[model samples]
Target: MTKKSETGSTKSETKSKSEIRNWAPINEIANDVRAGKITALSNVEKSIGLIEKHSEFDAIISVLDEPAKKRAKQIDARVNNGEKAGRLAGVPFIAKDNFLVFGGETTAASNILKGFEAPYQATVINKLEAEGAICIAKANLDAFAHGSSTENSDFFVTKNPIDKTRVPGGSSGGSAAATALSLAPFSLGTDTGGSIRQPASFCNVVGFKPTYGLVSRSGVVAMASSLDVIGPITKSTEDAALIMDVIAGKDKLDMTMIDRDILAYTKFNNNLTGVKIGVEKEYMDEKVDKEVKQIISVAIEKLKNAGALVAEVSLPSSKLGLPAYYIISLAELSSNLSRYDGQRFGYSYPDAKNLDESYMLSRDIGFGDEAKRRIMIGTYVLSSGYYDAYYKKAQIVRTKIINESREAFSKFDFLIGPTTPTAAFKIGEKSQDPLQMYLSDLLTVSANLDGGPAISIPAGFAGSLPVGLHIMAPQGEDRKLLGIANGFEELSK
Candidate 1:
């Protein structure tokens, strides 16, 4: 286990001054607050200050300073009264713009829903609030969560905290950037393919994508329903586990949720002596950058050092994951996005001659170029004659991908890989090339295709950029996967 330190120690005494109190884990922050060392209101103010200081990243789309302060006061009052607040009492967190929260607009970083107000909070938001966690801000994301980089966001692109010129991987770029810069203790992000993990890797934070049905998706804006998942991005694996414990469970509003015994995920951080980790041969191929491969090799060595057996494995079908994911996701996107047709909600063109014209005009004007491209591609793939050839065939390919992953896991406790080919690319590097943007997710799409749980943890640094190593498990094996990650985390440190 990683060594624990006393709260509020001076930077000079800590092993690394830069790692002192800035990105302290949620549990440590909670302990200090409960012990009267730090006030909830003070923490909120600190976060506000950090947000202001790092405005260049454009990570926060909107800050709910007033409401967050009021909530912090309430938490302090409850603590003073000696009443139990909950697991995350007084902890501040941000949610990706796609999650509906009360204090500000949930824009999804898209012009179409730029000023849209949500009538209710997402189930995850409500659950977190019940645990006394404050929503301090809404983080930016790719417009409507449609792109691999936040550059597609109609509002603004979030820059990497480590290097301002490099992109903070997306569509969860803002969430990852916010967590990395200590703008918030933790943030919630959505993943369809590699949205959460890739950005988390790029920003050098812990990002988790729970099993497809493990978390409720009731109030999150629909992207691709089959592959979409809501998860946490935080500074440490344990913090991610803590957030998951609070937000995960079966929800009646989401029928896809399955009934399972809830466990404190952090309790699984015991030794992973008997775990079997599969190192995919395809992931270590020549296509991967040398530095990224070195990072993954180091992480695998850490796992092996922690007493886990490491073995070479193959998922030949994984090569088709990106294409299959795009074909299937676009088909779903075309259907889910049809709801913003100028009549029900979102921006509407005022000068249209008729309803159809209004719908077409508004969409054409509101959506960014990347969004339009995906929609058009989706429309083409789902058209009558091509649906069977592209969409249907992709679904079949998806089944093969899922089967291969499942069979591979039968002999292994988890699968490991380089979260991305390298590190964060420069903003606009791949935005113009649709194929290049799609390939960025080559390493992450298979987990979504198989509907399993996966996490990206900072392995180490490559040059100045960060590299993330992914650990994945079969669906519903979240606790085991988290346990193995926690163990590896200890070894790496």
Candidate 2:
């Protein structure tokens, strides 16, 4: 089908309104809003409609209807007054519940934070709002962002939009599910391991994980201080780039963020001539689903045909990447979570007999099994007797993984792989086996362990489920990674 373009010309508008309403490109929506073809209020209304229409997915924790309506009116008023409303003008978006946004609670999908309202907004949310974007909802995730599937969420399990019976990958599952269902053009998600990319793969959206510290983490509920990175989940790589422009920068509050060149990610050229790409051997383990592997193989062929050189490389240290990631992440999680002792903030037990009982009762009643498991694991690893054997050793292995990744980057511009070993599995399929659940992040944890950037783009389908081609680059090379991903995305189309 052909639709009228902004230039009064006809262009292939293959996706129907029903198909694209929730997942439309950022530029397309922004252009229409600027041209007065659509009002910000109408866009927000449509997003609200979709959120209600797909309520069964359990992808959202809360909707900001009142605030969203007010914000849209303000944007429309600005547009009518002949004032500029910033780049993202009227786009509607959702932030993972972990982000501290006004109009709703920031629970991180955990019960311990049941009624904790954020005093201020997260840095990323403020940046996006500055660009005229409206956040209309808060998406669900695993409690404290601990699990690989939304099943670990204290509230509800976020069902996959593609197949409702299957799990939407997590701990960022709700963000990916919302994007897939077109509830928003783009959604903010945090990736500590494969949290963003794995879910994007399952939902067939563009999930971007910037180099550690590229986006400020201030006001976000900390999971793993070192591994936690803020990023976006969008319908297209271009949308991801557009979002990166607004959110990728250093903030005084987050001193870990580094100053770097600002990239006009939307103006990328899709030429891969003479570019060298590496297929990480560790990520292609025999455990990967056969159908998913085949889809990735075809994607590599497309890149090769685009004038890129492909080679097989070994990152042997990556085999230990998962263990190291879990250890480090849990250790950080334990320390970060200690502040939630029920007395200061978050959920508190009213029937507690004493102060110690209050702390024990609140945490015991609030934390889900998964959260408890992780907290226990984290405490054990950080304990005096096991610190050297577990936590310290994991850190050493993490360093080795980073060094090995750097060595590979010297030979190739980026590393490519399947984002997840398999497509979305049936809900509760792996919930009983924590080891099996952890394996879902096998191919993705190395990038986090190395503190590098990675992206997941839709490669193709594995039967009815979608597979993602994972592309990763060295730390601070996010622009290069996105440019290459844009080329691959264009090629896939």
Candidate 3:
């Protein structure tokens, strides 16, 4: 059934499953592309082919076919001409739909923003493309990155690659699922309250959330501005580290942007000897599933055996993480979502009697339930009457959580815990109960609340489901955190 081409190579030979899978790491692929061993066009096609093959997973929102192919050809030309190819030459990756990307409508999985095109690419996308990484598609996410499950998306819910019947953790579920399925070697996701790490945990990949402002958030869709931090979901810590090296830096566009570490992120020190790690009591509470607790405990024991100094640590304010995060996030979200008021870009009311009616109807019809709920709660908290009692108090609690985390770091190098209370839950399991849905972030929100770096890595499994070992370090210690996670990844093996 195979036909030989003019070059005497069968068409199928060019489409080998391994080539389509892109199993090589970033460095290997980049080196090969630069050396002309593999054409950039072929790399792009491989990623696109794999994405099409796994279309049923609902992981992608839109594919940048023409753009990606065009970029690939340009990169191929550069390498063919003996030019200096960038570090990520010919690598194809995915970005969460929430990100503002060129060549596709950055819907953010919400009807309000449906069909809206980005005026320009996100800073992260710009940086990646500068190094020859092509974003082949925009992955799905919860509507406006609002929910714990992709079930809240205005589009179809993204299926968990491991268990289609189950939910992929959200609002970065699509990115995680895509990364898990190898639709791309890696993908980008924004974490405001475990959006990145939770899904990464569920899908059994490495998800890293850098310290706040470490990566420029310019051009990304606004979520809770204070809490939002974008990171990667990839197969290994090394890949994430290599990516961090490229994307981690200050940008004039984002006022909050900070300078990156002087040391290259790719230089990971795997030695855990004498490293002090604290096991948070609250994160490993009795409420955590027995299987998950055991798996996490075993992972911790691996660290101890590898010469890490392990000890019990408590942060009572950790209990306030969830509540504080929700309040501040919602308040910020309310202010951010206010931009979609029918007049600007995105969906506007087609039938409206007047401006006021247009504003009301557009938002009412455009936003999903979860988005509306957050907007309402945020508005309520920021309202004059409740601002002092709710928003102000929440900010105070946030400071306390940050202080407690800093205090812990003063004594310990990193704090560890289970990324979630349980593994991937069945779709619609907790969607009906907001409280239960919120509980899913119980263990992962403090890092965001305090602007500390955090990462989730695979820790064996709880039954058949993957459990993530959540790791946290003090603010601005993202490089060290990546090093620690990489060490654990090696130690666990």
Candidate 3 worst ten-residue window by lDDT? 1-10
lDDT of 1 at 275: 83
What C-alpha lDDT, on a 0 to 100 scale, does residue 356 get in candidate 3?
Answer: 99
**How does each model score on TM-score?**
0.95, 0.95, 0.95
Residue 351, candidate 1: C-alpha displacement in angstroms: 1.7
Per-model tally of clashing residue pairs: 0, 1, 0
Ranking by lDDT: 3, 2, 1
For candidate 2, give the lDDT.
0.88
Error of 3 at 342 (Å): 1.0
Model 2 misses residue 173 by how many Å?
0.5
TM-score of 3: 0.95
| Residue runs of model 3 more than 4 Å from their true location after superposition | 1-22
lDDT of 2 by residue, 1-493 (tens): 1112222311211221245654457988888787778899999999999899889899999999999999999988888898888788889999999999998788989899988899998989999988889999999999988888899999999998878888889999999999888898889999999999999998878999998988999999999999999999988878898898899888999988877556575666567998999998878879898988988898899999999999999999888998898999989998898888999889899999999999999999888988888889999999999999999999999889989999999999999999999999999899999989998999999989988899999887776677899999998888888899988888866
